[model samples]
Target: MKRSRELQEELDSDSETAGTQPTIRPVFKVTQLDSAIDDELDSFAMRCNLPPHREALAFKTYDEYEVHYNKSHTNRCLECRKNFPSEHLLNVHIEECHDPLVTVKREKGEHTYSCFVEGCERKCMTHQKRRMHLIDKHMYPKNFFFAVTRDGIDGLSAPRESPRG
Candidate 1:
């Protein structure tokens, strides 16, 4: 029994020492061909996502100088000199070329009204223009007239009133 116990303790210590040895594995491995194959797969996947109409359409690149010939010669346009990768470029072009910076003088009896909202004094010439201004600038709530009441007017009483006799 004492011999068996001594043999068992010796075997356990040998196994623990063997487990502590570091493992050897492959490292720093990738080739140019592997990277090329990855890039090709990514481009192929992107091409597959496009619609049939878009895929059929030919890719066209136009000369910017030829596109803006009139503006290039006469005016000092920054947009012509450089490319702006945004939807705002057209708006900037129109404001710079067609529209004058100073306010235009209006003739007598021009159709204009002060904005109905308090603190806003902008004059709008048409109902559509006023509605647009309210929507874009003030961010006024839709159904505001029904949902809100003017300072002097009672909401319940105004709805119940008959036409003036």
Candidate 2:
């Protein structure tokens, strides 16, 4: 898509490039990871709980649910029945208060890292294991990360034709 001036202005304001490179805007590629997350959240059951009689509401992203929760719930879990003061407390509870009985490796450099998809307890000691989990366990397309991460070879990277031709 052609870059618009309004988009350029928005990007320029937020990016470190500022006026350095006025034409560049990083493009994001949606992958199975995003789809998986969205699919799980497509039927968010907690949103409609604000009004006792209201029907359940669906959210495409966690941020949307968080916004609704911050405004309406004050403190609640997206997938849990328990109520809390806010996400800050929830995060604190996990980071500081949670018992050592649970094993969720959040550090990237750690020997083991939690799965990319939520609700998946499997941890990975290597990048290949993580990729295998996504592919084997989740049945994600083998090429899902093809262009995004350049993980596998495909016809995506076309050879540039000679200008003379």
* Predicted model with the maximum lDDT: 2
> What is the per-residue lDDT of model 1 for residues 1-165, given as tens digits with 9 covering 90 to 100?
243654566666766777875333333647666888876555432222122123422222224433433222332234333222122323333332334431231234344434445556676665467666766677765544412111212213432221111
lDDT of 2 at 61: 63
Q: Which regions of candidate 2 are displaced past 4 Å?
A: 1-111, 146-165
Alpha-carbon lDDT, every model = 0.40, 0.49
Best candidate according to TM-score: 2
Tens-digit lDDT string for candidate 2 (1-165):
787787777777767655565455666767666787876766564454554225777665678878765544654333333333334334433432343433345343454534445456676675577677777777666665412122111223432211110
Q: List the residue pairs that clash in candidate 2.
A: none
TM-score of each: 0.23, 0.24
How good is model 2 by TM-score? 0.24
Those runs of model 1 whose alpha carbons end farther than 4 Å from true positions after fitting are 1-111, 146-165
